[model samples]
Target: MNLDWNFFEEHFPLAVSSLKNARSAGRLTHAFLLCSSNAEYRTAFPPLLASLAACEHPNEDFSPCGRCAVCREMAEGTFPDLITLAPSSLSRIIPIGESEDEVDSMRWFESLFYLSGMTESGWKIGIIHEADRMNEAAQNAFLKTLEEPPPKCMFILTTSHPAELLPTIRSRCQTIQLTDNRCKYSFPNSETLLPILHKLAFESKGSLLTAEDCATALIEFAETLGEEAEKTVAEKWAPRLAESENLESAGKALIEKRIKGEESCEYRRLRDLFLSMIHAYFAQLALLVSNTPAELLPNPELFEHSIRQNEAEEFGADRAFRCLAYAEDLLRAMRTNANDQLAIRAFCLKIAFK
Candidate 1:
């Protein structure tokens, strides 16, 4: 929400223009999916868009005039009209039930629609960050809001993986692909790791990438990450863990559980990061096969310099798409409690030859 106007002026003129045009035309949609991979798309962009829609006073460019009552309230984040929801501390997953309050997010959100906005502009904006974290029940409950959105109210759902969302939910909204060119993700921090990933992905004719080796590497990486996380967590909680002399069994058990949970979360986060990078590499490979311009692809310059586009072509278009699909499937599968080492190996072995 604290974005420099100059940054938008340079990188996202089209996006800003579209928002302004929709407002002027009086044809803004009730629901929108602001999709992007970068975390900013969820955290910052929605509030910016919401402020734009809710503000009545604006300059010629249609940017919100900071002096306006609505703009000031939005900036203060004390605006009753704007509702925001995200995962709570109790659970990372977004569910339908209340979040420690009497009324849950879904209930509160619904109740707001019935009431009129506090502002003169009469805009009720709801921004859901990491919206895809909503479970099936929450997503289903959200259909009611999408089905018949109230007048002068807009809901913006932001997520990195729009495909994971329900089809019905997706159909109800206008999806805007917000580019994050500012983000430059370099894979395999050390040159050593990059070659390993590439070789496992695109090793030549006779030297096919094997499932066992890929799986082994992935498992090893995951284990190393997990061990590192444990060490960090152990160091952080050393006082608590070692202060068992005065602590009761229940208190000590709780501390131990917290440490384990933190370690597990860190491990999963690391695994997810690696999987996402692999998925991105495959996506870049597909773009290369189609001869997409560097600017058009994610990680713009990284792929051009690091990945050989012709190598992807040699892998075959159908195969590339298939591998991409497999990678996605693997990522989704890993979300569950299932052991992913076998899954990773299976996917790698198939892609190695296929």
Candidate 2:
């Protein structure tokens, strides 16, 4: 992807057009806050915007010429006049030095703001990704720099959740909201799957990319789980049901193990996959209600009863939407350090009953 132009063309054409106008008018602001909910877009858009500002051959169109030395450097992440920051690599939080020498080093890097513009173009650009993740001290440290922005310098702050940012800092910059565009996908005679897929994409909270990944993972996981469940019901359950105590003991052990493993391993990836699956499942239900033929649906057995009962509108569509909302809430809680097993189990229970 020519991150500078192609990506922006898809999600934020209006913002890109505005940027072009600003560049043409020579009225580009010294600071910009690119606010968005999609982390992938949030991370990618700033560099593209930075390239636009720093491009050697910035035309009136606001697009950067990828062949130019400045654009190439920015794309390669080696541009001298551009700086970026996030939580430190070694530590999950921005590093704060305790010793005098350490503080001096930090201050020296911070003082780069005070220096005269070093590049021949006389423009310096700084990008801070996850600006909301900065700790109190780091925020305070950057506050002075943001308030007294240097000449010929521009700061671009990218954040997924702009509300988390400090009000004082946010007030200093021009804010631009980047909303996700609905991604278009084509399916061959598989129109039955389209509604389900669309629902999943929407549940992904504007990240169609995440929704696609989730859908693939869900299909794989569901296949594996279904096969396992069938095998257990046929071979294991039939033999063990006669011995009820043995079945109970085995089930308890298995549940305990899964819960323990979930607690130790970060389940963000799995939670995302599961949520995507739920979205797809509900979307399919909605389509079924809308008269999508049964044979075209994935897991037709799952929707057979609802379809035959003619309760698709009253039951299927509404239930699917409710499940989608639940999945989003679970995802949010999981990101905030909530108990993974409990969250996953709660979501599963809801879906199973619904």
Candidate 3:
């Protein structure tokens, strides 16, 4: 949708100027990376960028005026030229599967790449909301698109974690790193997660015996985190679901599919945020021990007073770095459908005793 260029000019002046300069110079690349850890900007900037591409009357700064019909369609999610591909509701993973026959048709982005757009503004924009969520099949398919993009077509990808994406995929796009404006554990359930992390962070790390207990607690924490988020999500969507449940079996099936999708995606997203927070806790220690600026800390105020200092003194910065590595591995495994408890246990053990 149309956005206030003023916002970008104020907050993201460099990013706006880069894109605008490229467009002005007739040098816009086939694919551009918009990396931001901020969740809201991840959701807001894609459509705004698409609107810029399709704006009939872009200002000198190259942002779309919100008044045009094209801009309105984008705001309404009815813009024919601006397409979006997000993760499937059921898996919270982009089902860019092998074929249309295998994929849930509603969430497909693979074949759509091969089709021509409505040619509105002579620029077709396809936005992938979470580039990291694309499965192997989806990534492979998209790599081909990048190799030989269609005429007047552009792909804008938004991602919080760039490491999860394939190196080849990353190589094809021009990366734009957005400032990390997103706060750590900024979601509704972060308060629930932070306390559990604090408990682990400050706990005496001596023997392997307590590692199992910590592991169990971590697993429970993840479960409770997901459940708390689901409760909120379910309540938010209950009215819409209530209406759909009374429909015929076929119609009811459709609504249920949508509901399940929301549940799975929301839970997974919340679960990942918790894992990221866990990593940030360890990373925070590593940063402080390395004498990095406190301003660079993702969650500067998260670690309890004297807790991280004690942990660093006891475990040493090298081990703390290993803990961050272990946490990253655990996050990777969990994303690949690894059992939650088993992965958390492995992570806890590796961090503490490995």
Candidate 4:
């Protein structure tokens, strides 16, 4: 979890190298916009960047010394200057106001920055996680501060989708792009897992983080339902009944308990897993139509037994493309607070019947 050195060695090795050049040339930008497909890694990147900016021995190649007071404080999440802004709930949009609660949090963050900026280290760090979630009002409010940043203040905006950000805000900062790598997952016996992993990677559209999450969830789901029929049943029915009012009332009466509940993060995780699975399933169909050899296909067993059953001419590459579009739409619907169970059920049935 030593993200500072780990991130430096991994995706941002070039950024680490640029650090020395920028410092030597006195050309470091006051603000940075770090863009990446992996939202989790983008969130982790800011703290590492902050540690690098605040390092006492930044001139030394081995700096960030990990054991230093500042680094230790950062690792403990008590670093005065390192502030993160994120959505307060699953709705995934930051609230903007001068209300008591909002004011309190903002004051605490501003105080930390003010104190850190006054330190001899001469750097204060602020990270806006999920910058895409900032509403227009919130973004506009932050724009004024970004335009005239406090002296020695470094603002790092981490977003999965930079296109959603205002052009003016993006134009003011330097940009760094980070892509997740499967090799960085550190799964034991990963070499043995590479074939399936590679398939999921392609299914996730090159998002290794999404593929890894799907792989892990699929492994767990497979263990839960040992039989193929049971697995398919759960995949199909879990969503339909869970979101229906009839089932909600029946469960409440039978179990003498409430049934409507917030969608669990585990459910969202599994939805992503199923989406990836559907992608791989159709991809295999495409390969089968082209007369791909069994050993060359990612899931030859599935391809030979199930996918090939469908006529290649009837179910062509367009089927796969349509499924991808459906998955994207489901993802957007989830973000907008649609009923997760209904959205997932509809998505699954679309692919299952296709």
Candidate 5:
């Protein structure tokens, strides 16, 4: 997803046309709710929205000129007036800060909304990525901001799970659902988990060794989640760290702390993504076993080379439903204080023996 017009034109033409019309008529809403299960689209839309609203030299159809200062600033993620927030802490919920000074909290975002640095377009944009991650208090606080929004500000809240948000919050914003044909539950590690699921469904013989082997695979992957996150953070921060070679001790410490925080947040996000993939596997298993068509499944790709409707009878739909429940339970448990390896081991054993 390049933050360019072609991305929208090719992938989301209707959304592009609608927003173009809104901007053309000066009817662009102060707040927009962009809902999509396509993670790529969800991740790409907000920055594009900001570019559309604040681009200094938009074309005839309100498409952003990708060469202007606003576009450059946005591309570099240094736009002063564009604030983006996502789930940050280890708990993976956006919090309402105790005070407005907390950098990553909703209160801090609210305070930024009212500050007086207007860009060339006089628009201040705040995007809440994965807005459903906002807990009750954060959502209520955001609802207050929505009710009394600042002048010349646009709020964009994006979520893959809209049901997790408050009703009032949803009502206050104009919603734009991005529709696409991409698999909703595809993740970075889907390939790794798909084979494990295939084994659980079609290869397992209910033996302790088979169950332990599945558990070992899951545990191995879980152990390295943090390493994967750190690798990503290192790649992103390499240039900055090199440029800061002469910085003072406190500045260096601050940067190091931020990098550490980023690593932790990235690990948690990846872990949740894997958990989500596990749930999707079992869910599609249940649906496929119950005679659902592959084309109609949430993850149709999982069935391309793996399970057939007729062969799925080896692991009946009833047991698939139970495994789906365990996957849900695993997700909930991981969200709490439950240890990741333990949870994975327990879940694998249950699925293998069920």
Candidate 6:
């Protein structure tokens, strides 16, 4: 609800401009599917857009006037016309309600939209955070409302996994790609990994020594990830622990267990970023082989050095494509709990022997 209008304008200027233009032209769609791989954007954008539509005093471009009473209410989630549905804590799924009275369910969410608008803006907005979390029944239940809502009604569905949603639901909404180049790849400690990729791509053509070194570096990177995760989580929990006076042993143990769980999750998230960067690296290589313009690459800055040095290696386009496939497989295997060190070694060997 606390949306940063300036930050959105700065980071996602195109998306913001498109939305504002649509609103100003009175051509805003009744339903929108805001898609993004970045979780932060997925969480932040829907409410901001809803606020823009419902703001009593919006700017010329339809950006919400944050000082207005309506904007403040929306920020505090007290706006009667705006409703948000998200996954439950335990199940991590949104469900079709047993009845219209069931709070925070698909049925309940739909029922609210039928009511008259509570504000003068005549905008009734519903936001579905992680819309992909809605189960089949929930999705089916909401389809009717998404297809035809009340007058001036708006529904926004935000998701990192759009493919999980039903095609019927997807077809009903206007798709908005909510990508921010600033942190899209967000590779952790990328400085240390890019050089290894440089060596693999141009310097060493499947050399055993380079592969061995890359494997060692990757394994060490994973270890460092764990250490960093632990330190970060511990520092976060330190102040709260210090503030607790005579905390019971059971409570302390529970806190410790929670800390450990968070540390594991953080480490895995960082590792996934590293994995994504590897995929991006190979993807860039394939693009390079295909004679793709440097500016058109996903991470243009990443390949600037190679472009500047005119280092187009004698690698075949097919080989570069194969490397992309290998990286995908490695990512899949890692997700399925494959041994990290072993995976790194095998991946390096595959690239080396290619």
Q: Estimate each model's TM-score.
A: 0.56, 0.57, 0.71, 0.62, 0.82, 0.58
Per-residue lDDT tens digits of candidate 4, residues 66-98?
Answer: 666677655544465556665545576765656
Task: For candidate 6, write residues 14-110 as lDDT tens digits.
Answer: 8889889998987888899999866556656776778777778888778889878778766645465777776644455788989988866888889
Backbone Cα, N, C clashes tallied per candidate: 1, 2, 2, 0, 0, 0
Off by over 4 Å in 4: 1-7, 103-123, 180-316
Q: What is the C-alpha RMSD of each candidate to the true structure, in Å?
A: 8.7, 16.2, 5.2, 12.9, 3.4, 7.6
* Root-mean-square deviation of Cα positions for candidate 1 versus the true structure, in angstroms: 8.7
For model 1, state the Cα shift of residue 154 in Å: 3.7
> Scored by CA lDDT, what does every candidate get?
0.67, 0.58, 0.69, 0.56, 0.78, 0.75
Tens digits of lDDT, candidate 5, 223-307: 7788988998888888878877899988788667667755765665676667767778888888888888788886687678887
Residue-level lDDT for 340 in candidate 5: 72
Q: Point out where model 3 deviates above 4 Å.
A: 1-8, 24-30, 36-41, 55-60, 66-98, 104-107, 113-124, 129-140, 147-152, 159-172, 179-183, 204-213, 224-269, 289-298, 304-319, 351-354
Tens digits of lDDT, candidate 3, 66-168: 7788776665454656656667543557766545555443225556555766655777777776788888777887888899988778898888888889999
Sliding window of 10 residues with minimal summed lDDT for model 5: 181-190
> What is the descending lDDT order?
5, 6, 3, 1, 2, 4
lDDT of 6: 0.75
Give the least accurate 10-residue stretch of model 6, judged by summed lDDT.
Answer: 304-313
- Candidate 4 lDDT at 340 equals 55
Note the residue pairs that clash in candidate 4. none
Candidate 1 lDDT over residue span 1-354, tens digit each: 345444555677787788779877767788999888755344556666777777767778677676777776665444657776655433456677764343335665567677877777788888776678788888998898799788888899988779888999999988878777455333224234445567666662234435566668766765576676677667766765677658888867755655664465445444455666767777776776777766788665445456655665676777778778877887776654366677777667767766
Model 6, residue 118: distance off in Å is 13
Error of 2 at 20 (Å): 2.1
Show model 6 residue runs off by greater than 4 Å. 1-18, 21-30, 36-44, 67-135, 144-154, 159-164, 178-188, 199-276, 290-298, 305-311, 330-349
What's the best-to-worst order under TM-score?
Answer: 5, 3, 4, 6, 2, 1
lDDT of model 4, residue 278:
45
